[model samples]
Target: MVQNLSTLQLLLIVGGGIAYTVGIPVLVKRRPDPWPKTFGYHEIWHVITVVAATMHFTAVSDVLA
Candidate 1:
């Protein structure tokens, strides 16, 4: 159980980092225009970040528990 949680935590952190660093930048460069009242790539990036953080927190809590 501990080993599984550790692996999951590591994967989430690395995956989130990659998404933030590479995926978000690519999307921003590809679509440099805001769609519908200033909601743009940056906003999308933030949403993804929040989701990733939430998932990470959940995994960590589970591991600790």
Candidate 2:
């Protein structure tokens, strides 16, 4: 499916991306540490989503292009 991006869509993407990135680290239980020092698969995915969202927003902001 071809999807067109909107301001709300971008905002949601950014919010979701940040939530995932921060949530995983905060939610995961680690011994001697509240946050995960070495993130697992889910955290890795979160990082990827955050990076993708950042790039997406940057692209969207360049409205003249």
Candidate 3:
């Protein structure tokens, strides 16, 4: 219904925002070579958490309503 659609929209917005925030900085500017590579590990962890949170949020939201 409307609520499910809203949840999905919210998820997409939030996820895309996060990806943009993390991706732009790494790609646009360059300071050190190993720095971006090293930092990418942290970014990957963030991505995994975001995905997990999205899945968990959707499941819980569906169950609640």
Candidate 4:
């Protein structure tokens, strides 16, 4: 386990990180306005990030001895 997280956990953490890096920036291009007060797409991205992190942390299992 790296940093006490198992292999699968690490993969998920890394995958999520990659997805966040590639996904969030493209949000602006996907939408015509990309305004929080208007369409709220940016705000939705932020919420997705928070939820992903929460799921990763909560789902991490203990390392086998």
Candidate 5:
């Protein structure tokens, strides 16, 4: 199945996976202090998640279309 993927598609999928794997642990381990008062780890995690999802979506759409 992987052999069918174009290089760009493979890269996007792998990159997204890597982002999620890296981001979640960092988000957990370095949670912000004063949890209600500042823009911090959670916000950064959300952005990373969005970017990762976008990368995954791009890859899936390219493959499906």
Candidate 6:
């Protein structure tokens, strides 16, 4: 079925892409407090990135013919 991209979905795809992209360097070079090295900051950030990418893909795909 053909579908169109909605505003929220578009925003999510764009925002999630930006966050997923920007979050990496920030999480790597300069991690926030309360999430020490032992807490797997990079790993957790990667998981978040995967989730965001998945969301972006799912939303974009839904709008395709």
lDDT to native, each model: 0.66, 0.56, 0.57, 0.62, 0.87, 0.72
- Backbone collision tally, model 1: 0
Native RMSD of candidate 4 (Å)? 4.5
Model 6: residues with Cα > 4 Å off, grouped in runs: 1-4, 33-38
Ten residues in a row with the worst lDDT in model 4? Answer: 56-65
Task: Please provide, for model 1 over 1-65, each residue's C-alpha lDDT reduced to its tens digit, 9 standing for 90 to 100.
Answer: 44565777777766766656654664657555467357776676667677767767776776679
lDDT of 4 by residue, 25-45 (tens): 657665434575766666666
Ranking according to lDDT, highest score first: 5, 6, 1, 4, 3, 2
User: Estimated TM-score per prediction?
Assistant: 0.55, 0.40, 0.42, 0.45, 0.84, 0.59
Per-residue accuracy of model 5 over 18-60 as CA lDDT, tens digit each: 9998788758876552353566778778878999999999999
Instruction: For model 2, give the 10-residue run with minimal summed lDDT.
Output: 26-35
The Cα error of candidate 6 at residue 63, in Å, is 1.0
lDDT of 3 by residue, 1-65 (tens): 44655666566556655755665554455322345556654455455557656655665565578
Top lDDT hit: 5
Candidate 2, residue 52: lDDT: 61
| Model 1 TM-score (2 dp) | 0.55
For every candidate structure, what is the RMSD over all alpha carbons to the true structure, in angstroms? 3.8, 7.5, 5.9, 4.5, 2.5, 4.0
Clashing pairs in 5: none
In model 3, the Cα lDDT at residue 42 comes to 49
Name the lDDT of candidate 6.
0.72
4 against 6, candidate with superior TM-score: 6
- Write one digit per residue (lDDT tens) for candidate 6, span 6-64: 77678778878887887777587755534565656676687778888888877777676
Best by TM-score: 5
For model 1, the run of ten residues with the poorest summed lDDT: 25-34
